[model samples]
Target: MQYFLVSNDPDRRARWHDRLKAAGLNVTGEYDPSAVIVTIGGDGTILYAARNYLEPRILPVRAGSSKGNRAAFDVDQLVETLQALEDGHAESSSRTFSTLTAEADGKELEGGFQALNEISLHHSSPVLAATFAARIEDDTTWEFPELIGDGVLVATPFGSTGYFTAITGETFTDGFGVAFNNIHTPADTPEMVLCSESVVVEVELLSTKRSSGAVLTRDDDDTPYELSEGETITIRAGDRTVELLDVI
Candidate 1:
């Protein structure tokens, strides 16, 4: 299969490019939708590949000092893995991961933002905690009382291992995980909630006498969607899924 190599580190990319070519693998300079993405960086590179390519197969190779939690192979095993696939001794495999989508005030955003991991809404200012309210729909509709906190995040199971785990100290195998960020009120509120993938989570930055707002960010995207006071941001599971290649 044709492969496209990508890395945030230029030196690592050049080195790996030579190795793959030396192994007699078919590598391409330009991205092809049909080509498998060989991500040669940290776990973040995997997310980057998935975001830029449309349903492209991903082969995540661990690199650098970061913890490559989503990596499929290590550097030492790279050429051997390719040989195995070439010889039909080991076949390429894949796993499907879910994604997320958001809307503001009942309208879908222009970019059709879909996050392979989590979508977070945080207080706009560092010194201020925003007041927010959440409405979750599962078997029944439940409205949570207003909360005073830094913000909140909704993560998929594939995302549970990232920020979700850091904030809630837990991971899930399926469904969406909802967690509050540094909440100050309703002290007894559950740290996290595991809801069905089919559930809908709506959060609003409450409008008070003071101007309050939050910033909505997705999966390492540089762009942050802004939410004004009284504006509701809706988060839900996307209809599509991302496939990772050669997962062991």
Candidate 2:
């Protein structure tokens, strides 16, 4: 079967390349539309693969000591996993994860960002907190105005164990989760559970200092979009989904 190998580490990449080649697997360094993308690293590598190759099935094999939350198999299991995949015995191990889409000012900022983790908005300046107002699309009566905090996040069920848990100390096996970060009101539990419904949040920079703003980031992306005061960002479930091979 056609396959694409994705890895940041040179040694791990070479090792897998040699092994897969010896096993008679057609592996390519470049992404191919019909190829199964195999990631030979941690969860970060998986996210990178997803960003570059959106539609391919991903099989993430942990390479280093850090067995991240999303890693399904370790490097030691590579041979067996590949054998199973080649034999079509790994079909039962497949799991699908839904994506998220974000829009700003009625323009689509992200068409469909597949985040196995979460999407977040935070204050640009560390010293200044951002002000926000939120409302659920399904419930018009529910509104949170003037939420002064560092930021907010929308996490999928698969992402519950990551940043969502870090902020709220809770996780959910299903449904999306919303959590507030460093809110001014310490007494209030800054978490909410929502069904698969869209959420709209408007952000306002509390600080008037120059270059003060908010940022929108998805997963572990290094770059973030800057948000002007009073800008509205809409988050909802995406149409596209990602299929992950369960190697554990």
Candidate 3:
């Protein structure tokens, strides 16, 4: 089987490269058709791989912490895992996770970026809080004229355990989740659970106490898109899903 390996650390990359070669697996430098992408790192590595590659089944090896919620296997089990895969014993141990897409105004973001975790919007300046208006379309339409907070986010079920739970103190097995950041009005914290059908969320930055703008970001992205005061951002469930190898 053809495979592509990715790792941020040089040592881990070299180690996996050698191991996969020693196991007689064909490892390629570039993503090719019918290739299984193997990532050796934490959850961030998995997110990075998903952002850069499409339609490849991913096998995430836990090269970092043992407590990683998204990791499927540890480093010590790499060889055995690959062996099982080679023997066709691990084909059934896979799960599909959905992604989220975001658009600014009417223009879609490049690559139609998908986030496996959550899509977040926050104040651009550190010292000030940004005010926003949010509208949700699920089974019905719900609108909040004024939601004053640091930011807001929309998360998928696969992401519910991450930043979503940290902000809302709630977890979901399915459907999408929405939560407000540090709202100035402590009593006005808004949270919602919507079905898998595309959720249309429109957010407008009304004002900022001291900052000039707000920014939008997705899971693990280093760069952020600036948000103007009256500009609107539309977020919805992505069309594609990520496949993760569930090692047994």
For each candidate, the alpha-carbon lDDT, in order, equals 0.83, 0.73, 0.80
For model 2, how does the per-residue alpha-carbon lDDT over 52-102 read when each residue is reduced to its tens digit? 676668887788776676777788887777788678777537778777667
CA RMSD of all predictions: 2.1, 2.6, 2.0
TM-score of 1: 0.91
lDDT, model 2, position 141: 34
lDDT of 1 at 232: 82
lDDT, candidate 1, 26-50, per-residue tens = 9888899888889988878988887
Clashing residue pairs in candidate 3 (N, C-alpha, C atoms within 3 angstroms): none
Q: Quick one: how many clashes does candidate 2 have? A: 0
Sequence-dependent TM-score of model 3 = 0.91
Model 3 Cα lDDT, one tens digit per residue, 1-248: 78788888878788788888888888887778578888888888888888878755888888866356777778888878778877988753777888888886566776575788998888888777778888888887888888776788899877788898998788887778888888876465555555554678888878755536788889979888787778888998787788987776
